[model samples]
Target: MRALVLLACLSVSCLAQRPQPCTSPALMTGDLYVSTQSEKLTAFAKYMYDALGKRIRLREVGSYNNKTFELDVLLLYRQGVVYKINHKNSTCCKKRLCTKFHPLEIPENASLLGQSVLGSSSGPGQGLLVNNWYGDLQMKKGTAKYLSQVTEFGCVPVSVLYHTDQSGWVVTSFYNNVIGLTDPQMLYPPPFCQDARLEDEDGEDPETFFSLF
Candidate 1:
């Protein structure tokens, strides 16, 4: 009878204990979307903030030959970060496009750049360029090389610069003169980018990141 009583007490004590509970659920944390230096081009700015390891979809508000198309970018966060200390740059464009030299305008129907900067003054975000009329991209240093063009809205002194070679376009947005990057493929976010909008989210440093599988 005593053994039975002790067993009963032990059973009760075991029942009183509870399994360990999860302290917290894994969550993705990032800053809320904020306006970058350029007011007209905030979408790209917002993208830089939310694009880490996620996908990006872009739709030009205007119509092209009555045919509207959307651009998709898959952002991969990387390890290295672009921290800009201080930089200065000046951009200029010819009223007449140098398109004859640079025929590589992304989204052929999209004319969001005529000419612009190639790299960002600070941050992985490329610098600014002067654009006008149709957004056709022209190389910096008056070269005849056309890269990519960005067609967002903003009248800030400088324009965003999007460029690529064999890879796809690397979009850059500016806020308060700050620069960031947004690449759907998780391109190498420049290590010294200041703009939060242009950094690659999926693969901040692709090599450092490992897959669970």
Candidate 2:
């Protein structure tokens, strides 16, 4: 009886350590910061995301090649359209969205690295508990490996790192101030994009941009 009990306890411990799938809130609004290790590009954006409705919108300010620019990106999966608007010049480029909407969720096949506290654990509510997960994602041209950290309780994304053959060594995104979506209209394209010019077939690929989310 003692040996049987020990074995049962071990089984439970193993099961408890297994990685569990987690999904973000269906509708969320947050601030996103993106950086690339191989490029001198960095962006900060306020974003609205609707995982269930397949819509996303971002108002971003980014610096690249010593140039600063403000841009807006709107992705509507149902309409299969992506609008990239330059806020500085009031130019908009409408492009066909090639990729499907991928929700911000820990993939089922992701391996949990472990869990850690982001701050002091000495007092209650002093720190945030986060889970780390790693996985390889199959992309159109190559496989991209990713590491993600999210809040343990609500599965809110804290940060994500991706390495892809085309995208160089590393691209990381940090999420902050995530909350449930407040305004539904935030997901819609701006009025200035109504007369946006359609991008050429061989123009900037939307697939590479959408994969970040």
Candidate 3:
């Protein structure tokens, strides 16, 4: 009887520990700090989610080694706007690039629900399994695509398992990333160029964030 009771208690504890989504939309607007590490490199990301007006503004600043990248996206459900800035300052000469994309298109079935913003969990395993999906634009090729996956645990996002795509797969884990919201932006693109805007004349680049690492 004690063993059965302990098993029930453990099951309840496990369910309670699973990451839960914010029940309130107001709670969804904040900053998410995500850090990732691979065999050869590490990346840190700061994501700002603002539920402002009738649109959602998502800004991301990612860094690895000497390369830094920024993404500013305004989402209006099925359509949105995007701005990308990538800068590198090292012995390879300082280069800053900015690309502007207006009326950015989203997939017909794009959605952001059941995503973990501020949560954590522990289990009787080496790591957790998770899934993720997001729309990303290729900085160099000026392309965009929806990358979806059901792989392993990692935090750029704590988990992205609410999407409708099931064909993508990858494995990842978090080095150190936090889930939360922020008001003032933390990281931003460097101030070197003023009007370095370019239209999306070359079409969208076919690069997903998952494919990079």
Q: Per-residue lDDT for 131 in model 1?
A: 46
Residue 135 in model 2: lDDT: 92
Task: Please write out the lDDT profile of model 2 over residues 48-158, one tens digit for every residue.
Answer: 889888998877778765677676778899998888877667677899877778888899999989999998899999998999999998766678898889888888888
> Which parts of model 2 have CA positions greater than 4 angstroms off?
1-19, 86-91, 195-197, 201-213
TM-score of every candidate: 0.18, 0.83, 0.31
lDDT of 3 at 1: 100
Per-residue CA lDDT of candidate 3, range 1-213, in tens?
A: 999999999999998765432221321334433333231222333334333332334445555344565544333322332334444431111122233322212233444323322224564554545533456534333343444332233223343211112223222332233334444332222354234443544533222232231
lDDT winner between candidates 1 and 2 = 2
- Show pairs that collide, candidate 3: 30-181, 30-182, 31-180, 31-181, 31-182, 80-104, 142-204, 142-205, 143-204, 143-205
RMSD of 1: 24.3
Best by lDDT: 2
Compared to the true structure, candidate 1 yields what TM-score? 0.18
Candidate 2 colliding pairs: none
Off by over 4 Å in 1: 1-60, 70-72, 75-157, 160-213
Give the alpha carbon lDDT tens digit for every residue of 182-213 in model 1. 34323333333324443233412111001100
Please identify model 3 stretches exceeding 4 Å from their true place: 1-44, 53-80, 89-158, 162-183, 186-194, 201-213
